[model samples]
Target: MTVLVVAAIAYLTLALILVYAIDNLVALFFPDAHSAMPLNFPTLEKMMAASRKYYRK
Candidate 1:
């Protein structure tokens, strides 16, 4: 049915958006959170890299 198809599409869109938002937030606030993981995947490294450094003087 057309209604079912539309609902499915909307659900998928929302799911994608949710994942993107979470990834951005994690990258922003907890970039090194995954650094200790044993796996050395390139994609994981990029995702875990921080956009900016924090320092105290």
Candidate 2:
């Protein structure tokens, strides 16, 4: 039925919006929201390589 189709579409749209909002919120608050493993990130050397100095002054 037309009503069922419309309801399904609305449900899908709402679900997509919810997923996107949650993803953005976590990415904004958490430093590494996408990665699942530790030590997968860059080390201090890599940070220095990227010109990001962490001087302990």
Candidate 3:
């Protein structure tokens, strides 16, 4: 049980870090598209908006 709990915590930490990295990368690569969006993990809605804005260019 203890090991399981430790593994879950580690997995969540990694997931959060990965999301943050991806968010930053998106903002870096698509400044205009991401400028109006909040600085958080990319949800489906945000991704769609960014893609739409990018493709519109």
Candidate 4:
């Protein structure tokens, strides 16, 4: 049971990392495509901009 739980957690973590990597790659290579979408995940640049704005306040 414990081993199964550990495996599940690791799988989920890897999946999330993969998704984040793909999201960034798309944003990097296809900026116009990503911008045209109505709903999209925040990329690292967006997150960093938000963080900077927050810290400036």
Candidate achieving the largest lDDT = 3
Q: Give the residue spans of candidate 2 off by over 4 A.
A: 33-57
- Per-candidate TM-scores read 0.53, 0.54, 0.56, 0.55
Ranking by lDDT: 3, 4, 2, 1
- Candidate 1 Cα misplacement greater than 4 A, ranges: 32-57
The lowest-lDDT stretch of 10 consecutive residues in candidate 3 is: 33-42
Better model by TM-score: candidate 3 vs candidate 4: 3
Cα lDDT tens digits, model 4, 1-57, are 999999999999999999999999998987874444454466666878999999999
User: Residue by residue across 19-54, what tens digits does model 1's lDDT show?
Assistant: 999999988987775555566688566655643332
lDDT score, candidate 1: 0.78
Per-candidate clashes come to: 0, 0, 0, 0
Residue 27 CA displacement from its true place in model 1, Å: 0.3
Q: Residue 57 lDDT in model 2?
A: 31
Q: Against the true structure, candidate 3 has what lDDT?
A: 0.89
User: Following a full C-alpha superposition, what root-mean-square deviation does model 1 have from the true structure?
Assistant: 14.1
In candidate 2, what residue range of length 10 has the lowest lDDT sum?
Answer: 33-42
> Where is model 4 poorest over a 10-residue stretch in terms of lDDT?
33-42
Judged by TM-score, which candidate is best? 3
Q: Candidate 1 or 2, higher TM-score?
A: 2
